[model samples]
Target chain A: MSIFKETRITRLLIISAIILIPIALSGCVSGGSMTATSWPGVTADESNLYIAFNQSVFAINQDNGKVLWRFPVEPEKNQTFFAPPVLTEEGELIVGSYNNNVYKLSASDGHVIWNFTGAKDRIIGGSVITDQIVLSPSTDNHLYALDLASGNLIWSFEANEALWAAPMVDQERVFLSSLDHFIYALDLATGKELWRQDLENAMVDTPVLAGDLLLVGTFGNELISLNANTGDLEWRFKTEGWVWSSPAVYDNNAYFGDMAGNFYIIDVASGQQIERAQMGSPIATTPAIGDNEIFIVTEQGDLYARGLDTAHPLWQIAIEGRMLSDAVLANETLFVASLDADNLVSAMNIESGNLRWQFAPEK
Target chain B: MWDTLILDPMINALLVIYDLLGNNFGLAIIVFTVIIRLITLPLSLQQQKSSMKMQDLQKTKRWKDLEKKYKDNKKKLQEEQLKIYQEIGFNPMSGCLPTLIQFPIIIGLYQAIIRTLAVTPIQLLDLSGHIYQSGFFSIPSSLLPLTSNFLWMNLGQPERFWVTLPIVGLFGIPVLTILVVISTYYQSKLTMATTPGDGEGQGAQMTKMMSLYMPLMLGYFAYTFASGLALYFVASNLLGIAQYSLIKSSKGSNIDLAPVKKSVKK
Candidate 1:
């Protein structure tokens, strides 16, 4: 009787452990605690839209919402993508993955051209394509510049923390914003640090080169203007909340929103707010500028179109999931992606708030 | 309510410790665990005393007689056991109350570690809202992206020690997982050894099963989650053993055992 009881207890304990271990460790799985850290990134050309979401990079038809092709054919368990893919003049798609690899694919059909696995950590920001070099920033605290044709390392510059903001390139230099609370300018040819300025807070958006002034938004709740050439602080426009997205520049003015849902129009030259409007939700993506209107998406999945002159919203439409990526405008159509697994991408008529087509992929 | 009361305070405290410890996250976790253990010492001692009293009760003749009498009638045995417990001024819940109170703290510590190592954008965004922005308790935004590197381990990822051997080639060993398993086993063993008898009772069987299963469960957790959490498990287990030993050595010290009387019979 005693032996039977002991055996039964041991068997019960084993059974309980078998049932409980998976349930207990489920939270530790990748993307388990949160669905995703960032939203789906959409980049467009004249023909197709390339979306870098979790587990795959998708190519959608521009005219009709159709899946053209998805990279890797089968989703790899270890690879996750969120950085928007950049297109080259040579019709090549250059993108980075959370697996710490930079892939160059043929734009016509998704075929691997070259793969560069040099970075040591996840790549959170999209690559900036220049004439000669492709600048990719990673969470490993390094901005890597690869040869556009062969995907070979040209040069890399190390930052103090993760580089979540894409590099902004101009004629002779590239400007980088790092979570290390500093903005760095490096020479385009050699990756040598030209100048750097500590903004006293972390920056997560690309530094906009608006003529001679570089405009940067920071977690310090300020829109700062710096001399593009000297890295000197020009002026600071304080906001009600942290400015998380890059400013949209059009017609000599800067348009942006803060995490507190306040949208502002600032005069580019004077760095003074021309007007401010409340969106009622946090905005974390750059606004797309059209002919006479501005398009923005809030974290609460609201899409709004506002006239540039009055800065008042003209129309608004509700999306399904959180809209955290920039709204892209091309060919009288506006494209937006969400964190929803079902309703991944939606294309809308730019003139009206009417939905043109919504693309929901099969599970 | 949980965030406001436990998570937010713990996260901020860890950050404050990290700042004071010169940005070393490993050192901060260690110090924070020690501080938490110190803060809950009173409850731990209360629990220890209750366990000791229960063990003493189990060794008494009245308890053995009640078990033998109730071998046929389980319900009457339970009723008589309750009566005897009341007569002796002992509450069985006293031994479990401290452990129940600690569940939220353990969860809070786990969440605080994950939040402080905010490696993802959404997690980082969530962390930003929880941080003290402006006040006497404000942490600098310069510390936004904290350095998770600690002694060849990225505290944000699972820990492994990579080694290149001649015949086996390159291998990654889970060093912290091993430590967590060993420390947990030792602590559980020490806890079980303090119990009165090793007979074939249901309670003894359950205790034995727990001793065998607890370490494996914790080892699985240590191997799967971020290394920072694994570090917490090791530190917590080792400290628990030390605490048990210290309390055991001071068994002769004066303690208020009002709930436990000498007689176990009505």
Candidate 2:
């Protein structure tokens, strides 16, 4: 026999093996580290730090990290929160969720005030509450402005891409950076677009406002500065990796970290790198500034307290889980939120980097 | 090992083609399949030659005699076959090798489609890591949301029944599963039809069953998995048919589905 022969059984077995192996292997190769499970969005009033994390919002006591209250008080299917809660002047705590709803709860206790399910997609970004309207940007590519009292839709401004970041309200203009690679500034009252500037790539952070300067970081590895009122380009600073850490403006410099782990303090107007510090991991949120200390948290759960002016590390500490949310400063303590499974929020002493208190959601 | 060896290269290659083909993912998959078929043409030819040689050997008097003499003692029949196979310097498993090699490519291509589509943030971040830095085939920032909207379908979604198509209106008829099923049937039939069913050790029986079973199995996959994978299946089966036809024509073999027609072989 001058040929190769295979049994029909062998062919069937080999084909079955071929089919089964990849299905098994492909399961392992799926995007496993799919964004941190907990992205702690933290905001503070004078007495308590309100955090939206892991489907529930909590108002932790500022003096001692005890859970004042937890929203829903029960778990509901598909209702998870990653965006931090915002406190309105009238004391309404507004937070967004993966379940395509913006929940309004009483800040004093986690009681359901109202729910805004107008946004067609999940509300991942923090909602901006003004005198009359509650503006929430959603993954559905629309920024919904609801009446603050009734939770009714005032109007909606649509973008070409998913709106992953909260809107920046500066005076009469509301600025929003979209994952569609455009930053739109709209008239606060009418929800009419004032100007839209193309940033060339998706931006997932809220645009930072500093007087006339508006800074936005893009996944395209650039930090763009635009005139707050006009939405005109002021300066563009290119980074080594994606500028995911929203810049913290202080004095004359803007401090931020790129996805490549390079932390920089850049002069806002000059577009010059003031100082560079190696953080060794991707920074998740904007640097929080309080009492001369600049708080920067990496996605790996490391927190570094560097001097706001000199960009020198005062102290650095690692939390149990990844710190994906902005840290709130209340008095002498830094309130850090963790996307970790066990701990929800931890408060650390500002100068010493010591653990003050840890707040865990009741299981 | 899968990522560095197979998936990374396939992803970069797909992104390159996607960029070149006006960022149309469907066209990119088709062109990529054609290029892959062209590159692996030598392997297919070698495998086809080996299969034809096996079929011819089975039809010969010596093989029939061996089967008759060792009708009860299967071990003796196998020893005789191995001795002949060694004497001839021909390998039966060689035909299986190319197909075994193709398993990774097929799986890698499936994964690459999903990764390039980048439906989630982490998926996009993963894609960014695998991107080719060179200008030859790079996804520019302008193509941020590489719209999976190809031929009226979101390639990342399942091929729907067209009743809920208004929700997926960007896509066309969603006939990818049907096309895959049809192409799979033809491709399988082309191979099974060409092979002479030597009525030895249930070979003929298995071949007859496969003509129906394989298409349904592949169609089941096409119906459930991402439409992009279904597109790959349809493209791959069609190209396999064309390649088989080319080989058959070159060898002057009869082109017909023997069981279906009942006239091509018997």
Candidate 3:
């Protein structure tokens, strides 16, 4: 009987160990990296970094790369970062999350200034903050403009399909794209549709403003430049794979990569491809531009810092996991958040590409 | 609830595998299922041992004595059984341990699937942004734009008769369903047959009834759920049969039915 008891206890212990070891290992792994897949828009307000991830807004120190404070949002399940938080002229952080709600958080202590609930779909596109209004496109297929101070809904522009791409606020119009294959230019104050241009396929990337042209990428692998005023097609460049990454306009060139690992540097004037750089893995995050250096992180977690003009690698840092979020540049420091690596967020020196500080939230 | 428990995970797991395997959802699911089974093996073995011991105890004379002692008294019977179980260091709750363990896994697996095979814009964006595209089989382009072309199902949505018929008929009959029912029946029979002691006959009788009842219950479930889940059930049952046969053969148990004998009068 004792022998049987011993064996059963041993079996229980073994089973427990088997189950617990993985959980422990997973905890350790998760703790080592800030590798959250949800792209919480990373915005810096001089001294602090505001990141929206998994129903929480984390305020981190710009210098040491430490989390100062975290404010939790309610409705936990499926509550994720949809659009990157926008820093408003009023100094409040405005962001929309997957819970079908938009929150205005205090930049200093990470407190909710106010929150407004929209339709049921998640808000994946980052909020576009203007001087007086904040606009966010949602999976509910509506472009919502809320009062920057009170969190009151001003107006909403409905689309045919869900809007995953963040709306870009220009001088008079808010340019936004949708999975419905249309780029809409709406009046920023009134939420009236100014003009709409139908792309060949769904637009999943946020439109970037380059001079008078609004540059956008689509699910159909087309990079289109439209006249920001009339929504007229300026130029379009075709690629072999889907374009999910938001295009970054630097100098006279628009740089973007595709799902097939091909990076294109297109001239903003004509939409003609000037240079194409192929990386080892697919490029999913937007490239970070600093001075003459352009840093691009791949889905495989390889960070390549190259000369903006030459496309020659200045330095390369290989994170252990895939890079999900775009790298942020603040005060000569490059902050990268990955979902695959043990460290969730890491600070690298802009010049030397040396590791400065790292934080893994789950660990 | 359905989206969280079923649709989302199924899609997510498929997308992860697709991203990893470049769109081969079938291979991804198989590999994922294998990993899950491997993880759950210890719990499964523990449950199996507990079941075997319970069967063994039921056949012992001690059990019969207690039953006879409490034949006319229900409360006393309960107390007596508890006392016997305490003495023997047996827990009836052991039978539920495996089920308890499986519940969370089922939820997790469902989540993985939904996250992987996300077809809609919202689903895809949510999925693509979250999961690591690292999987064994590349998601096939043929399924892209994401089609429900596996047998008779559009894997993106719930399984309907309109979708399942062609897939079912493609096998020249509903052979998969038949195999599913047969394998389930035999697994119950094998467990019943292997139960030690005199109660084996009674256990076998119970097993026979269960075998008939379970298939019907499962058929109803199959009709209602997405064909992906039905496919999963069939795969799991087949795998169970193989595992059972392997264990039985290794244990040198010939699970063939024995002839019932008349009770000898002293």
Candidate 4:
């Protein structure tokens, strides 16, 4: 009887490992392929960091620069991905592909727990994983709500044009922008349209919710903050180029970059431009805040760590390739991935801007 | 006359229906299969008549004489076969036309699904942006974005263990992938055709190979495509069987129920 019990326990452990191994291995690849062109988004949980490149999702060990697993979304050769991966409160990594699919993977292992397919169009926007629902926008001009656990579609909200902005979910409401020149507020539970405010230009950046005001940027280079509950405009800040990067809200200050390589720090409450810093390259990547420092990457492959109060550069590092992905902050270490350098994920010491370690896929 | 006027419109109408129902693509495919069967009723009847006529011609003494005369020379065989067809006032192309038409339509549907359900930045630009923006079911948005997962597939990514569901489910038996492979194999067998003088033994061997090959290829694609497309394929196959049976019944042929059977005698 003792031997039989031991055998049963061993079998159970093996079976469990077999089931969990793929989930664990889902985020291992670090965008190693030569053909992969972009690493637009990277997010992290407690243990793993998720990066999106081409059609694959990579999960990296946050402690050490090791890959845990990789999930390859094999779209047709012509398709390309641009959106970042979003993490849910319950640890679901939600991402969409150019092949019109929104996927829910186990954050721990990268295993697909569920998937939603879009109409015959690409899903360029990253998914927004809320507490109970996952909101994804698609080029199919639709916003889809999926049950995070079962992958069952709860509801969908349609727009007049393509939806390229990642959704922002707060409480029971979800805010989204579309290329149709509109900003929309919808009920997260049923996907019911609450209100739509016309922006008159394509809104591609994910709206940043600061307190009760929601700040959104448009293709026309105008940044507008609206009341999150009423969709009423609070204030607007204009820039020289299109604002595609989502605004980073920190310490009552809203920080964002534009296509012209200019970073603007605006007061969230008043929409006053407090300071503007030029990075000499297009500021396409979002800014990351740490202590008194603000980190921004440019499309020309320049990284700048600037002081938030003084608007002066603390350190600047010029990597080989353009930095398209947002910088991720974990503790004191800042991680940046770039598409130009064969999608390499590099870690920089946030204080000194020193190269700590980098992980490149083995060819 | 039938191909241009009736068949084309019917196929187009069916495609419209596919767009309507669930935006849930898989369900649309099943509906398409049923509609295709209904549209090809006349051609199916003609095919049955031609098949029966060919079987009768095979038993005739005149056919045997022609076969003997053409036995050695391939060119002569072609001449004699043409002569027999001419004498019977039969056009072989007529019987084959339905199958040929169906092939392109099926391929068109597949291409349409792949092109329309794009999920990337580049692919989104390539798709007909106008159609993607069209609303369906008063959903206040385009009908294009729907979840593809029915059981265990993301359907849009290459099927790899890293992204799919864990192998075990419901009683810890791990039945999801098994169902995918088995259904695909059966679907391939049902859709394939048998050619004559494809020696019974050789034909069986070829069919077996084809059955395995087609399922594996589709399974691989299903793993890579959005699960919606896979659902469409599965639904299309099952619906295709129903369509085939309906066509056979309407034509009053001795419906085989099984896939085209190879002759027992080698």
Winning model by lDDT: 1
Model-by-model DockQ, in order: 0.28, 0.24, 0.06, 0.03
- Chain B only: TM-score of model 2: 0.81
lDDT of 1 by residue, B1-266 (tens): 98889988999999999999999999899999999989988888887877667667666666667677666876666776676567677776665567657756776787888888888887776676678777899877667677788998989888999999899999889999999999999998888766434457666667777787888988987887788988998999999999889877775423233332335333
lDDT of 4 by residue, A116-199 (tens): 764556777788877777788887789888888877788999998778778888889999888777899999888899998987
Lowest summed lDDT window (length 10), candidate 2 chain A? A28-37
**CA-based DockQ, model 1:** 0.28
Candidate 4 docking classification: incorrect
Give the per-residue lDDT digits (tens) of candidate 3, residues B89-196.
Answer: 777566556756675675556445544454433345444434323355333222333333465554443454433355455322444455556776777677555543
Where does candidate 4 stray beyond 4 Å? A1-38, A73-82, B1-266
For candidate 1, the C-alpha RMSD (Å) to the true structure equals: 4.4
Question: What CAPRI grade goes to candidate 3?
Answer: incorrect
Distance from true location, Cα of B219 in model 2, Å: 6.0
User: Model 4 residue B203 lDDT?
Assistant: 34
lDDT of each: 0.83, 0.76, 0.67, 0.65
Q: In candidate 3, which residue ranges exceed 4 Å CA deviation?
A: A1-37, A73-78, B1-266
TM-score, one value per model? 0.90, 0.80, 0.61, 0.53
On TM-score, the candidate that comes out on top is: 1
What does candidate 1's lDDT look like per residue over A96-123, in tens digits?
9988999999888889999999999989
Per prediction, the TM-score for chain B is 0.89, 0.81, 0.64, 0.61
